[model samples]
Target chain A: MNNSSSVIEPKTRPIRKSKIDYSQGPAPVSVNPAWCKACNICVALCPQGVLEPDAEGKPVVAHADNCIQCGACWAHCPDFAITSNYK
Target chain B: MSIAAKEAGARQDSDVVLRYLRPHVKFPNMWCPGCGNGVVATSLIRAIDKLGIPRDNVVLVSGIGCSSRMPVYLDFQALHTTHGRALAFATGVKFSRPDLKVIVITGDGDCLSIGGNHLIHACRRNIDITTILINNYIYGMTGGQTSPTTPAGAHATTTPFGNTEKQFEACDLARGAGASFIARTTVYHTTQMDRLIMEAIQHRGFSLVEVISNCHTYYGRLNRVGQATQLLRMFQEKASTQPKDPNMVDEDSKDMIQTGIIHRDTEKTELCDEYQKLTDSLAKGKSS
Candidate 1:
């Protein structure tokens, strides 16, 4: 009672490195000043301290490398001022 | 930063959700900075995107209030009706075209006070409409007056000495009125909000998703709840995923805002479908 036809052998594919660099992390958080209401919410809620308020209180990406890309800043931004290409 | 990073930063001007908004409408909405209404609107757009519901198939009906103004900005068939009448208008839309998804955006004042009757009746009928009641606790647009959902002992312009009456539990009210689906989420819980809104929209019977939003400009200043961030943090700290015990006293549940679906009854009949069946039966009898 051999059922060889019913089961297929698993194939092992070669592992390859992707062209995109994994070290850079996700895209830098971009704040649109035109729409920014200077809420400072993104700056306040960012866990990584990636965003900081400018002279006018608008958020700017101060530590782009520290960004874990958790999306807390953009998700919490009430004015829709924060955006990331990776999001 | 690499070339990709540079390009990402350069492309920040174009927002992913901007396509969901009306092009003619101006940027920088009228809501105050850090207002929770924006968070709710964004979460709603995300939910709609995840569901892949076409913009044309959606009809947003809103009554007069800050939250009600959401329909105006979104690029969909919208009707900004009079105060507290958003649910009634949405019911008519759903009845006429069952294919079109009707969503009502109403605020605490407009929904519970002005349109409370319509809300209960809609729930009783079990209409296939989604109502997103934004409970900001105060009338934000009209200068921070006390609303039905305003917590007792909370300060508002009308309740300067603190509200003497008990706060209305919106989810409990909806459940009692026979809504098939009743859920509550706050702006602080963005992920939960998006999921609950999507679930409510997909539900067949009357569904109500009460979004506990913050009115920073008025409610925050009046109540000294700090800025929007502080208020959102408060939500994060106080919101419990566990539903409040039915027997829990007001004092015990006062500080806790329940987050997640509280009640769901899918077996009940939908108003529009039932009405259609009745009409079809009558027409068949007449023809026979």
Candidate 2:
């Protein structure tokens, strides 16, 4: 069939689905307050409810032990304020 | 140590993501609260950071739009050029200094209407530049003018009567124009967006990622989408992964904006790469 080329394109990637490990603990979260703009995106998007915002709207490690290290905050912080240590 | 002291110590530690950003970046950022541009910016930073591309090797170029303000916040060699001309400027940068990784941040109107020529030509040439077109359906910074991607019957400030023009599917346009890598994802789908952008950055030929973001300030208020968060929820409901079957593409995702990589042609040689090979062969021929 003329469409044989397009049909076979998806097969190129193979089925090696590599899942990222978000559960490598004791993963401590590091935050630089100076870089923090008190954006609540980190607190809102946290999958484990690991972060809680203080009165100033800056995220605090309310439950550091519960962090699964998914890196949602580490990658999504507008100010680039947070980091997740997989160690 | 006490709880307060320990928390303070943890706060002092630096983040790897922060290294990509400049500490002296201006704030409060130009994008409004819940405006998806911030998320797009952060996702872009993560993609570049994940690629481990050196700061000196990366150049972020942008046109005049709310989304284009992304360059000001990053530490990359950024150029906030004229409206709808980011791609044109980026092409020049890519041609002159082919060694650098060039990225173009543009908006719906900025790219499609004004910079439309640049977009299509860039794809046709298959230049080694990664372009992220932030589509919000309206010209948010220009106070909600109807852009080329504004859906049929959608309301904007400039269009009190619902827009009758058909929306341009950006991914389809890029694909038709011969871009090597083309992906579509929304701002709310940060994880998928992150991965797609990372893949786009690493792709050899011309690449594009159209991030369907929300303009809560102007487009949201005028169109009654409520706020940024509500628009994000709507995106979640309306977005879906594209089907592998090329024929099922239109039929399967008629009601939704299809996400994920829609098209990729890995065999196509990049503009700079081809140029280098041509020059190398020419030099050899002359010597012979």
Q: Which number leads on DockQ?
A: 1
What's the true lDDT of residue B206 in model 2?
94
lDDT of 1 at A17: 33
Error of 1 at B5 (Å): 17
lDDT of 2 by residue, A1-87 (tens): 011111111222223321323355334577767656654556666666667766666778886655645666765565555776542
Residue-level lDDT of model 2, residues B62-101, one tens digit each, is 9998888888888899989998989999999999999899
lDDT of 2 at B207: 97
lDDT of 1 by residue, B49-98 (tens): 77989999999999999998898788888999999999988888998899
Question: Least lDDT summed over 10 consecutive residues: which range in candidate 1 chain A?
Answer: A1-10
Error of 2 at B9 (Å): 19
Number of colliding residue pairs in each model: 0, 0
RMSD each, Å: 12.1, 10.3
Deviation from truth (RMSD, Å), model 1: 12.1
Report how closely model 1 matches the true complex, as a DockQ value. 0.22
Q: What share of the true interface contacts does candidate 1 keep?
A: 0.56
Pick the lDDT winner.
1
